[model samples]
Target: MPAPAISFEFFPPQTLAASFRLWDTVQALAPLGPRFVSVTYGAGGTTRDLTREAVATLHKSSGLPVAAHLTCVDATREETLQIARDFAAAGVTDIVALRGDPPKGSSGFVPHPDGFASSVDLIAGLREAGDFNIRVGAYPDTHPEAADSGADVAYLKRKFDAGASEALTQFFFEAETFFRFRDACEKAGIDKPIIPGILPIENWKGAARFARNCGTRIPDWVTDAFEKAERDGREDLLATAICTELCSELIDGGVDALHFYTLNRPELTRDVCHALGVTPKADLKNVA
Candidate 1:
């Protein structure tokens, strides 16, 4: 079977220097011809304006489809709906609806009493706001705050039932975990696309810490590979190899499309896409 198409995720820049880096990343990966790239909103909606601005820039300048992530952590229903309308008017039809994280230094997530209580609610709101292509977050290993894996799957199903066009999972290290999650979604009657979120091993220590916080497993072999490279200064080469192997294995396991968590870096994603034989569309010749 042929390799699947791919998408990518990028965060909005917090400063001018970061903005330049983000544009560089976009230029590098646009040649891969991702189905769409998503710009993440800040936790607790702190960077809502910045996120919208960045998404709009991508839409205007990149000539590639862009999805703006909208979260319901701190905004009122009216506020969230208004932002959705703004995106629609700005020629952005794809929305990644999410229940965002709590404010920094907070203990846990606390929902807005009159707003969405979860991602499912946010999906429903987006659907009502417009005829947008909505996406929601998923977790193969169960969300950290969920009661259990079964409950987490059920929640993801609810998001689909509410009209989400697809779900992008949290990054996972093991393909078996994704296969099991797909099985669960299939069994639950979720027919929408469930794309696996792939995170390349660029910074092993940082990635490991994040995986632990998000409940994604960190395989020993993955760590061992990075550990061996600690003395060689070949982390970039190793990152390329590890991510390529992971994606190749996933394709062999029947995955068609991937959503890469680019972490604002593109070389790794670019290399992996090359390895997978995904070429940029001809009209986009200047993307690189």
Candidate 2:
């Protein structure tokens, strides 16, 4: 199979040390020639300025396409659109529009009085405000807030109708989960590109917690294997193997593109990409 097109996601750094780590991650993985690299906003839009700064810096310094994450969490409609306009002014036009999580202590997402009500609304606003390649979130395991899997697909179709160019799914354990979701989307009359999100398990405990919180079902075998690997001090080896196998399966299953949630760590993601025959291009390594 041909090497699949790939993208990487990173969170904006809140501290100086974290900034260095983010740069190091970019340097390590940029040579792999990802189609674009996205920087994420913190929950409740807490890292709005940081995300904008990181996105602009990466776009200017790395010579790579940078997609900024914009969310309707704590900002007003005008506030949000101005950010998109600023991104356009900086020559960054790709966006991952989301109805972000509530604040750390909040019960659930409660839209700001003057803000877009949901991701679909945010998408429409972005479409009206600028010329952007908009990407929206999708749920393969059924969103925690969704009534059902079918509801998730229906909601995604609305997002596309609102002007999103693509959908990037929440990370899931099995490739079959994505295939099933894709089939459902097709049946729902949604023909947009849906890219599976890959998470290289960097920490079992953290990943398990994240999966549970996001409504992603974890197979017992995954738990058992990680337990054994942790006991044998081979967690990294097992992580690389598992992620590589998953990517290989997806590629063999005819997936032509992938978006990896790198979580600001590059080793496992880079290893998995290399295992999938995505080698570094000599000319693309200047992303300092």
Find the candidate with the highest TM-score and give its number. Answer: 2
TM-score of each: 0.96, 0.98
Q: Write the per-residue lDDT of candidate 2 for residues 99-212, one digit (tens) a residue.
A: 999989999999999999999999999999979999999999988999999999999999999999999999999989988999999999999999999999999999999999
TM-score, structure 1 vs. true: 0.96
Best by lDDT: 2
Residue lDDT tens for model 1, 1-288: 476799999999999999999999999898778889999987778889999999999999998899999998887899899999999899998999988888889999898988888888888878887899999999998778888899988998888899998899999887888999999889999889899999986788899998888888777988887998977998999988878877888899889999999999987888888888887667645558
Over the full model, what C-alpha lDDT does candidate 1 score relative to the true structure? 0.89
> What are the runs in model 2 whose C-alpha is more than 4 Å off?
284-288
What is the RMSD, in Å, between candidate 2 and the native fold over all Cα?
1.9
**Clashing residue pair totals per candidate (backbone < 3 A):** 0, 0
